[model samples]
Target: MNKKFYFKSYKTKVTINGETITVSRKGFFNLVLLRLRTQVINLNNIQNVKLKEATNFKRGYLKFVVTKGLKHRNVTVIFNVFENEIAVEMKNYIQTINNK
Candidate 1:
């Protein structure tokens, strides 16, 4: 059995759910404003992972491609984290998921 882990920011989180990574937005009001977007991608579905460092007042993004031929990406975006520990944890978690 594995534990569910959350790499969280002010507005969003990338959570580990068994063999899948669930990207979701926090706060109910924001959901109403942003139109409620959530994405779940299996570790096996992932082909690549990229992290872009965030600047002041900007959120960093953790992007992974599930399908090679997809038109757009649906990834996890977190605020107040550029080169942070949570990012490192998420990256390590991805590697673990890949190894399994």
Candidate 2:
């Protein structure tokens, strides 16, 4: 799967329909950490995606609330996108996913 983009620490690898996003955090003592915590959101399962924008430089963050309804809990992802270019692209791409 080709990586469409990177949102802060998360790498988004998109296929034809859905995408797998992965984020890895370092363990204690600078040890290498495995990626056991990856968020997989099927585009078909996504009910809604809401965005929250930051106002200032100190608070420039991109937030997405993916609602899957009652069957599954909602997922909230926050990315520190210092610039708006990538943020807008990601938002639009996600919107497109919803439309499909």
Candidate 3:
């Protein structure tokens, strides 16, 4: 059996307390990730925001992770334009392990 690898790009929306956040576009994952990192650590004083990873053709791949106050959540997803589909994997353990 051949193992299948998944990597997709898509926009992510995050809403908290009835507020909507906008995710960035493709080829801007690094910038977004750095911003989120700062927000999580309270360095930038960002209370809420959306982080997104987009793949621009053969250029490269991106990953995103966002953290807030006492709550931790990760949106693991893959998007394929060729197949017109989005795949997601949720790893709840990330938050639990980091809490220690």
Candidate 4:
């Protein structure tokens, strides 16, 4: 089964299936900024995953670090504290995948 997360405020959606993770963006502004693109990263190419837990004062983000010199750019999703649970889950899942 694919695990999915949607962050409405950021206009982004994330999906994890098998050994790959996909990040997609939506909304008119995001499209105008050329951020409305889909990025897929193979678990094996991910070097690290970071999750900055959100607090009352600030929002948090989830980031994926890919191997150096690769065509794939790093992926980041900004989210509010309410969305932190899924972000943490994604971070853990990716880390476990990289360790195997």
Expressed as tens digits, the lDDT of each residue in 55-80 for candidate 2 is 55433444444455667545544444
Give the alpha carbon lDDT tens digit for every residue of 18-99 in model 4: 8888899988856787555888888778877878999888989988888746565667888888888878887887777667
Which residue runs of candidate 3 sit more than 4 Å off their true CA positions?
1-64, 81-100
- Candidate 2 regions exceeding 4 Å error are 1-3, 9-36, 57-69
TM-score of each: 0.68, 0.55, 0.21, 0.81
Lowest-scoring 10 consecutive residues by lDDT in candidate 4?
A: 67-76
Ranking of all predicted structures according to TM-score, beginning with the best and ending with the worst: 4, 1, 2, 3
- Model 3 CA RMSD to the hidden true structure, in angstroms: 12.4
lDDT of each: 0.66, 0.49, 0.32, 0.81
Q: Mind giving the per-residue lDDT tens digits that candidate 1 earns over 1-100?
A: 3444454444665667667777767687458876665778777777888877677867676678776456545565554554566776777778777887
User: How many clashes in each candidate?
Assistant: 0, 0, 1, 0
The numbered model that scores best in TM-score is 4
Q: lDDT: which is higher, 1 or 4?
A: 4
Q: Where in model 4 is the C-alpha error above 4 Å?
A: 68-72
Residue range 1-100, candidate 3, lDDT tens digits: 1112233343333212212223323435634663331112221223332323334553222233445667655433334444222222212222222344
Question: What lDDT score is found at residue 32 in candidate 3?
Answer: 66
